[model samples]
Target chain A: MTKNILIAGFGGQGVLFTGKFIAYGALIEGKELSWLPSYGPEMRGGTCNCSVIVSDEPVGSPIVNEPDVLIAMNRPSLDKFEDAVVPGGDIYIDSSLVDREVRRTDVNVHYIPATRLSTERGFDGIANMILLGSVIKGSGVIKEETIPAAMSKVVSAKRQNLFDFNIRALALGAEVLE
Target chain B: MAEKVLMKGNEAIAEAAIAAGCRHYFGYPITPQTEIAAYMAKRMPKIGGVFLQAESEVSAVNMVIGAASAGVRVMTSSSSPGISLKSEGLSYMAGCDLPALIVNVQRGGPGLGGIQPSQSDYFQATRGGGHGDYHMLVLAPNSVQEMAQLTIQGFALAEKYRMPCMLLADGTMGQMMEPVELPDSAPEMAEKPWALTGTGLSRKHNIINSLSLTPDELERWNIDRYARYAKVEADEVMYEEYLTEDADVCVVGYGIAARVARNAVNAARAKGIKAGMFRPITLWPFPKAALNKLATTCRAFISVELSMGQLIEDVELAIRCSRPVTLCNRTGGMIPSPEQVLASIEEAAAKLN
Candidate 1:
């Protein structure tokens, strides 16, 4: 099975990091994958996005035009990419920042209130991970147990102290879905 | 021992060059390819290798010429505009028969274009970006793994034929990250008998020069170089074919566009359109024989590229126009999606009727 994912938000919202977390998870699971960033002037304090593919077979195109899953962390991202979701696909939105409702009736829309949940839980600045947790639980795209090992690979030594907080964010995000 | 790690294409190419015994690197910073220079900057010093950021692309290429003339493996990397600045030095390298590696992680073209992915430099890379009848051995890598493997191969081929070799990549290939298992170590390089090592009365002093003023002597020199080029053309053509056995339509592309075209081919096959793909790995020695052979079996062809129509021209010449050929392209730093390529394939298949 192939999972085409598009993660979008503002530059400082950890949009690219969310995609990298999933890409690393897929890599740890021994799956073929690719992570391509929308890299240019837009990456500097502006809207940014990345396309990630996790597949059993070799990934063909890393640019996801019609993604199977769209993770929108802000209002602009949700409005911009909602219609591009494949029919019967899933769209995960952060309800705390994006007050707008998804107009697409053909897909499953999950609003996680990621920002409020993360802030209340004392794990601020990691709303992306909470949304990622919800996607993991709702979509089951990767094994839940594999994420910690993947996180170890992604987080550098200088930021090692934040590993525990990130793990909690993932758990809290998954709990919202439960 | 070889280990599997996730690496971006530009960083992988830099690491691979270091492992390939490339100790001297000279380049100016450019987008989509700056990671290569950055990596060399961080690691080259630890290994006692020479890494110099020249004042400009012109100076960088000339520095490579100087290093390569000293009989050591050397390299330089830049994006589209920077590469144009190095064109004059490239001609000098070819004329002097110097062995060096030049990497062009191409961005959009025609005078300071955007820093997005593009393959518009196909003509410049394959047809000798400089002047006076020369061909650089050009290798186009599609994936991150190939980014490393092909850099190693580029160095080997450059030394083997006493010519400059180009690793032609694009912004997409330079930025994407994937799992790659690198080689255990750099391969052993061959000895350079024509190197300008200072003669201490042990051997004849060697001279590396491109200024053959006499027309007759320059003509003879050009003939000798063409003979070597002919040998490389006969020997080093690399490509990949997917599902072309009984297909009526063949999709041709290279680098990232080929990856996109493969997905389109698979989609067309699901619709029973009988489509396949032919990807050229070596752009200069350009797998013309394989394309010519496939032209006999396929009914139509679609050339998918990120440029307006650079590679399609080569496709037309390769098949000798025996079959109908069409182009599906996006330029100015835009990449064509699979759906767009699939529509082109359907159109090309419909033309068969």
Candidate 2:
């Protein structure tokens, strides 16, 4: 089976890093993966995204037309990619801020309060990672334990303390569905 | 290389330059590429390399040209407007046959357009933005690894032909990060004996000037320059051909757009559409021969670019051997999606069949 994932949101929302964690996790898991980012001026204060394709065979392409797993961290991201999820694919939205609801029978939609959960867990500005937890829990694309390891590696070496909160946030989001 | 460190593209180029034996760098900082200047600023002094953040891009290029003329491996870089400012210096470098590397991390253009990644500089780069009949050996790199590799090759080729070599990168290739395995350092490679470091009292003073008083001498100089360009065209042209063996359609592109086009070609093949991609790594002295050979089997060609059909002109000229080359592009801070390219290829293919 092939899985395509797109993590997109505004510039500082950590959307790029969110996708990085997933891609790196998949790579570390010995899965064939490709990660590509949205280039140009769109990278600053604009919507930034990275598309990842993971397959058992060599990935035919890295670009994704219809992502199997979509993680939307903001309203614009939710509105833009809500319809892009492939039929029977799943989606994880930041329920804390996204007010609108999506109805699609073929795709399973999970509304998780990523921001609130992150805030409650003392992980501010990490709503993207919180949203990542929701997607992983919903999709089981990677082992829950490996996600934290990936997060720690991405957190800037200077901000080593920040990994504490991101790990806590991921665990909180994982337990919420249980 | 360097013990397997994670680095951004800009930093990688700086490291690659040093590894390539470049001890001289002069540039000013611009957004999306500031890290390159920053990397040089920190690393150059420690390694005994000369790093100068010039007053402006114009000053930077001239400094590089001067140092390079003195037989030093020198370089300078900037974005769109900055590169535009360096045109005068580039023309001088080409005219004087100075060996150097000039990097243009392309951003939007036509007047400080924007800080977005754009391949719109194809004309400026390949057609000689400066006022001259000379061409800079343009190398387009699609990935971070290629960015480093090409920078080193750019310096080497510059010395080989005694001409200015350009690294035509965009903001995407500059700011993006990826794992890169760097090649061996410069000393490991062969050395140049033509360097003007010193001629000694045994011989007359060496003068590296573009000016010639005699009309006949100047005419002969231009002819000599073209001869070198012809040799470059024959020896240095490089490209990548993928899945074009039995393909009915050929998609031509380079740099980031080329990477995207490759993915789209794979996607089209999965959908039962016979598609292939020809990515020209060298823009000037373009890999025309390769494309011409591939044209024998392909019925039609698709020109994929990020500009308004800039490289399309070149592809049409190259593939004039057999088929028509259609264009698929997105301009002014836009990147054409792979699906869009596939649709264009399919549409163009439908016309012939």
Candidate 3:
């Protein structure tokens, strides 16, 4: 099985970091994966996106032109990459940050109030992880059990204190799907 | 076997250079390649090594020349424009027959082009980047794993040939992350008897210079360097042939473009078209003999590239025009999708049928 994932948000929104979490989760499961970030001037407060490919076979072409799963945390990201999703694919949107509705009806769209939910749940800045949890639950691109191991690898030792908050945010986001 | 770790291609190159015993690094920061310098900056001091950020690419390459003259493993990295600035120093290093590794993580071309992935520097790299009759061993890596592996190999090859080597990668390879298994043991360093180490009263001092006044002497030096280059061409031509044994349409590409072609080849095969890929690992040597052999069986060839049509010229020459060659490419930092390449493959297949 192979999943081509695109995660997009503002520069400081942990867009690349959330993609890294998924990439590491794929690696820990012994799957072939490639992660590529959009490293242009957009990285400075503009829209930044990352492409992550997890596959049973070796990943070819790290650039994802068509995504099977897209996590768009802001309105511009959703408006930009909405039509690129394949039919029957999944798109998880941060409802608090993106006010517009997804225009496409062919793909499954899950709207989570990630930014507000994280704020209410005491983890105000980790809306990216909340969408990651929703993506994992809705798409099964990765096993939820692997998130802890993946988080430990991605979040450095200096920020180990935020580990519990990230976990709680993930749980809260996953609960939204039920 | 060592445990695998997921690392960006730039970071993997730095770690592998460290593992290969390259302790001295001098470089200028550039887009899509600054991660290598950042990584070296963080790790070098901890390991009692030198990682100097020079004032400019020119100064950085000169520093590389100095470090190489001392017979130490050294490296410098930059993007396209920065590499152009270092061309003069590159010529001097080649003329002096110094061993070092230079990485060009290429971006869009011309003057101050956009900071995006590009393979437009193929001519500049394979034709000798500076004003000299010399060739650097240019290794093109498609994956992050090969980014690590080739850095280690590039150092070894440079030392063996007593000439500079280059890792001709692009922005995509520098930015992507993949699982890589770096070697644990340090690579064996070769003895440099010709290094410019000051000798005591017991022996003669060694001098490193590229200047030769006499035309006859310079002629002989050029001849000698070409002889070594010929030996390298004969021995170090590396390539990969996938599904070409029974293919009617052959696609030629290197680096990230080759990865895109791989997917296209698979899709073409699924459509009952006999398509395959020939990826040159060493871009300088051009893998001429292997490509010539494939030309006999494969009726048509498509040169897939991230440039207008640079590699197509090499493909045509390598096959001696024996097969019909076509160009399937994108330029100015844009990459051709698999669907586009598959369409090209279908066109080649239709003509052959």
Candidate 4:
């Protein structure tokens, strides 16, 4: 089955990178995929979002009307996209910032302190990776082996050390849902 | 001999125009298509050519006009909104029968739309993009490969017709990387004997102006330019018809949209619905004859675009509205998927039944 996944958070929080890792995982798992980033002037400061589709067949609209999975790394993201979840779908939020409980009972809501955990792990900017791992743990749509390869492809030559931090973060976050 | 290289659509256009002996370029920086300007800025000076980033689109097109009047091969590029500003200069160039190339790496919208790929400029391109009763020789490339090849073609067509031709492309075509073969035997630019180069002692100076005082003289120039355009339509109608001989439906599109439509046709055929695609390589002088012929056999047409229906009008006019045509699209930089196009085809097929 095709999976529609949306990842949203403030810009520079690695929201887009996290989604890219999942998309790469899907690609490695031999799924047809498309990743579309939200285009707005406030791409850097405001709510940054990216949508990914992994499917057995060709993906239709990359813009999801009802995302099967929503990964919100901040309170605003969770509040904005909480209703976008399909009935019986799942929502994963960074609970440290989103103190309010998810009122929707139609789907599963797993709150993770993604940013806080990354900070605790001494990877100040690896929250997106943690969220990605949580999604993998939560959805199980992609194979685990592909995360590292995708993450490496995205990191610049200047920031080579990020691979270790992100991988460890993903592994720990994935362990949480289990 | 011309060589082959893998390049982005924007860069390839820059390379090809240079190879075609087009030495003057003027443009403003814009995303997705900025590579063309970047490539030119880097290379043009070394080749003893002119590459100037003008203040804006208006200044850029006008600069191109000035260079062209001086008997130089020249070009400029911009996106949709920028092209809108250049329309006035374009109309003037058309009126004066000035030969030049204008490339629009089209993006979405009526205003400063986001810098993403879009083929929404169909009407602006085909229907006298700038103004008046004039028409630009518009070429639409579906791949980075053609992006290089057609830029050369646009320059030649402009000179041949003594009018500016537009290489109409979108951001995707501008940004995508693909392999391309460069043309062999670089073309020696045609001599402009009547150009505004200061007349020597023996020759009469020719003035290149769009405004003519007398009605008769202006009418005469219009008739002559139209005659050249007619010849262009007769000789330069280019299109690619894939698996269309016995198709149940035809999807008409150009540029990146054509690529999506091709994938859609494959999906539709796999589902046992006979489908095919007619990709018009030229947006103006818009492969009308070929589409009309294909219309005789195909059940209907689905015009897949990235914006509200624009090219559909041409498809209707080309076939004289003989068959059904529908639209499948996404907007604001969104591209419709193969399945979306197939859905539209199936919906159109259903109505036929």
Clash count of each predicted structure? 0, 2, 0, 1
In terms of lDDT, the poorest run of 10 residues in model 3 chain A is A154-163
TM-score of 4: 0.72
**Segments of candidate 3 deviating more than 4 angstroms:** A157-160
**CA shift of B298, model 2, Å:** 1.1
**Each model's C-alpha lDDT?**
0.93, 0.81, 0.93, 0.81
Model 1 ranges off by over 4 Å = A157-160
> Lowest-lDDT window of 10 residues in candidate 3 chain B?
B196-205
lDDT of 1 by residue, B1-353 (tens): 48678899999999999989899999999998999999999999999999999999999999999999999999999999999999999999999999999999999988999999999999999999999899999999999999999999999999999999999999999999999888878877878989988898998889999997899999999999999999998999999999999989999999999999999999999999999999999999989999999999998999999998889999999999999999999999999989899999999888887
**Candidate 4 residue pairs that clash:** B2-B184
Whole-model alpha-carbon lDDT for candidate 3: 0.93
Task: Assess candidate 3 and give its TM-score to the true structure.
Answer: 0.98
Please give, for residues B1-353, the per-residue lDDT of candidate 2 as tens digits. 44433456788899899899888999998865777889889999998999999989989998988898778888888888888999999999988888888888888767978887789999999988899679999999887778899999998888888888889988767766555678776734335565567777777667778888899998999999999899999898899898999889999999878877887898888988889999999999899888988889998898888888899999988877478788898877667887898898788778877
Q: Which numbered prediction scores highest in DockQ against the true structure?
A: 3
TM-score of chain B of 2: 0.96
Q: Lowest-scoring 10 consecutive residues by lDDT in candidate 4 chain B?
A: B1-10
